[model samples]
Target: MTNKPTILIIYTGGTIGMIKDYSTNALKAFDFSQIVQKIPELQQLNCTIKSISFKEPIDSSNMNTSYYVAIAEMIENNYDTFDGFVVLTGSDTMSYIASALSFMLENLTKPIIFTGSQLPIGDLRTDAKENLITSIEIAAARKNGQPIICEVCLYFEYKLYRGNRTTKISAEHFEAFASMNYPPLAESGVHLNFNEHHLYVPKNYQKKLIVRKKLETNVVILKLFPGITQAVVASILSIKNLKGVVLETYGAGNAPNEQWFLTLLKNAIKKGIKIINVTQCSGGSVILGHYDTSVGLKEIGVIGGLDITTETAIAKLMYLLSENLSDDEFSSYFNKSMRGELTNR
Candidate 1:
């Protein structure tokens, strides 16, 4: 006889787990274990679900490295017991959390689907039910008894996206997430249609999952604007113990060509600070040497961020900075895609 696949739901405090009070008209956290009773559609799924939540729910804006480590450890403790995992977090920082998890969990062979809703689960027209139910279905989906999705993913609005590639692009719409650089891994219509070619497959199925706990948070994002003053750049680079900078530049990674601008960045790089050139535009790769304005950046040892999103760039920078690699090694690793976070050149 075939046994049902077991899934673990890790709720890290988000709108999806909230319910309303008719008397006070206030919102409060609800019991996720009673989800099956509230939403009977979950009961129709063929898999068994077990839920665990944080002691005190937090807003996504308050998410930090400590929480990231806790979530990874939770999965590590139950990796062998559960067939898959569905993590629920606030949509505001869902992309950042998802991207961090993608890098933290190496050699992963089972699905880790991150999802959340724009509205409360108890709302009359809430999107939580669809997002939660579909995420579980995708996590439990299998072929020939092997899990079909073997990577970290974000499921929202009937579309499944690679966790590292997704970004929260909307707030008022049901479709709140988008993976502009990559295509949807799967879609929900009359039936679930999966793009198998885009799915990640582990080379060694017998290998165990590796969970990384040490992450450095001494990083800052420097966004360049038309009137970005030299004072602003100097203030950002002068931060104490700053190890990395995600430089959000103009189109195709072009930055100001002024001598002072170039000098500030050049001196920063000389002081062992890693600066990554990522595009400020929502969609496109950073071609450092393709334009006149960007040539100075290429000459100053600024690493091109390629098509990596700012959220993924931040997570990748933090993860790599903890390794304490050499300058050459850091640049080499950053250029290459470590978990499908960016397109390899």
Candidate 2:
């Protein structure tokens, strides 16, 4: 009875916190301070629950770096006071926010789960109640008095997924996200089932949290297509002060073998720009040299993104560039799985 966990819920605005006003027919934010009153299921969990909401909630579309920094700061300031945290954000940009937070917080030893509903909490058919209830349960899950989910994750539609490995794939269905290359960490059925073997186990539990704040935004994504022009390629690669490029190549990292195109990429690398090769397909890895087209990209110094999602690749490049690492160190760290963002070969 002395080991009951304390979980903190941070509401940063989303459909989950809204209720309809009958006369106006408009949605309004609900007070989370009365969360237990609205969702009576929370009282059943064997944990003390507390909540915090943004003073002015913004839509997921408005989420950005500043918001991420603020979330990180809040967790850091209250790290020792709470055993676990659940973040409520809109599904539209949940992957981006969750992935960024996974990278921002290093050596995390407690659960930081993100969840949101597709419908308003007050709607008769809303999915908010279940999502909110289970997200807190997952956050409070522990083993041998230690947090079981000691990493960042997203729970929606009865499935729990690794945060950085996820991407939103639907707008009209309850299953709005999918991890094409990875499996769900946990699933909620008649009984909550966790894939214990797949969980991340940290090596050092006593390490202090390392917060990365200097993320660079001067990166661009160039998706490959048939008949892409050399001039267009050169122009994009030559953006002023460009530090990195996420080249979305064809199957298994294939790209044009044309001299001008290869020359353009080679020139960028020579000028200290870090170019990462990622596959254009939704569910495969970029294996440089697996084909002739991509071989030249590898020869020209492009780093392989290795099955990382485009969203994660972009965020990872920005994070790495912000660290101001040297060209060699940048390439090394970018290819490594710092936040379970990439699959190790």
Candidate 1: regions farther than 4 A off: none
lDDT of 2 by residue, 1-345 (tens): 138999999999989889999899899999999999888889999898999988898899999889998888888887889999999999999999999899989989999999999999999998888988999999888888788899999999999999999999999798899998888999999998999887888898889988887788889999989989988999999899999999998888888898999999999999988999988787989888888888888888999999898888888988988886888898889889888888887
Q: TM-score of every model? A: 0.98, 0.96
Locate the minimum summed-lDDT window of 10 residues in model 2: 1-10
* Residue-level lDDT tens digits of model 1 in 1-345: 137989999999988889999799999997987878888999899999899998888889999999999999999999999999999999999999999999999999999999999999999999999999999999999998889999999999999999999889998899999999999999998899999999898888789899988898999999888999999999999999999999999999999899999999999999999999999888989998999999999999999999999999999999999988999999999999889889997
- Clash count, candidate 1: 0
Report model 1's TM-score to 2 decimal places: 0.98
The true-versus-predicted C-alpha distance at residue 7 of model 1, in Å, is: 0.4
Q: What lDDT, from 0 to 1, does candidate 1 have?
A: 0.93
**Residue 219, candidate 1: alpha-carbon lDDT:** 96
For all candidates in order, the CA lDDT equals: 0.93, 0.90
Q: What's model 2's lDDT at 76?
A: 89
